[model samples]
Target: MKLYSLMTTAVLIASTSAYYVKNQKSETFSLNVTPVDAGTQEECKTCITFAGQTINDLLQFVLQEEVDVCGDLCQIVVDKTGKEALGVICTILCDVVGIKEFINAIQKADLDPIYFCELVPACPINDNGDAHFTSLEVMPKKGPQGEFDISFEYVSNNGTGTGMLAISVDTVDGIPLGDDFLNFAQPAGTYDGTIKLDAKENPDCDPTQGPCETWEPGTYTIHLSVCNGECGSNHPHSAIYDTKTTTFEITQN
Candidate 1:
């Protein structure tokens, strides 16, 4: 009789504790958006860090001062066609809030969830393999060689950096933006550029943000970083940290 009573008491206590814990806890949520041009494989991952256990909680989190939604925190606007939407999205770990409701909000607003990626070296040209910027030009109206010229000036720490820079522009359908610059497509696309800094320019030393010119029109994100060599280094390579991005419209004549 005594043993039976003890067992029953323990069971009841355990069950009650479990129930209380379940009711008190909330699920954690992570969201990311990567905006890619509709036609090309190129994309830019914009990260908006937020944490909440439930959908209502998550929405409250977004409503917070720190969390950024479309147009307010960041603006991903299509300049020509006046189309605005968010791209590249990763929402992992949803507990309570329905994914449908969350997605609907994003689709209605045309906002893409920002995604995250590993920190890759920005430049591979210099001996240090660090990317440097001296200038950038965005021709909202025209580009070099009839291609939208989103060009930049890269400098090295030793005054020498060499590497190929790839410019990827996203059109709604992979077709290059028009030459005359007048046929701006609606729901216009985004352009993300990645510059490969040559290994020769970096050699052994790292570069710092000395000076760089402003970028061209249209939405833009610029990143500059140093490449840590494959082998673990006994030599300390100082990190390359200097980046700035601004958006402006160009009125073509």
Candidate 2:
């Protein structure tokens, strides 16, 4: 486990019935939360007991009428306390139900943490090597529609673990694109696969429409992110090991 640090500043703000506005005056604070390995109920309880008061204060501040409930409360807490109290709150919350549960709770509350804590297996020690994207090749690179093949490699220098690859596209236009995710069982060596890049392939685009009608001619930015261990789990606990970006052109044909 790695210690997480959160930095924030306090600011005065004016409020109206409709909205809250920020003021110019402010103060800054830094917080560092120590990591704890908790697998049992007693361990979780003990961790929470130590930081109960700070968590209570955070909840109170977040529930205030003038506060932005959807925003990050951890930063606000850090600003208010100007100490490591915010980190303690986060550490306790994460230890209570693991990183996945903690993240789900934060998302459900529409709150953001300063930095997400990665999850490691409860029973086994994780010693997997980091995964990375080695190469990317697009077929018919100038066409309106084609396929992209990406290669990934990892070394089991530490130990054996699972890996995952997540890919997404961003167009010059604001139109939404689709994303693809794949999982790898092997912890070492190389893996490769292809993903279709046709506009009709996009679920958001109507299949009846022709490719030209559905896609705009321009450039698309592709993003690749790879993670090791707990790769297949929803709200995975593994950290992103590598990220790569590349561009493909869609020309009028």
**TM-score, cand. 2 vs. native:** 0.41
Give the alpha-carbon lDDT of every model. 0.23, 0.40
Query: Which segments of model 1 are wrong by more than 4 Å?
Result: 1-131, 141-146, 159-253
lDDT by residue (109-137, candidate 2, tens digit) is 22211112222111222345555556665
Mind giving the per-residue lDDT tens digits that candidate 1 earns over 155-179? 3344222111222232222322111
Each model's backbone clash number: 33, 1
lDDT of 1 at 165: 23
| Candidate 2 stretches greater than 4 Å from native | 1-127, 146-160, 200-213, 229-236
TM-score per model over all chains:
0.20, 0.41
Q: Provide the lDDT at 89 for model 2.
A: 55
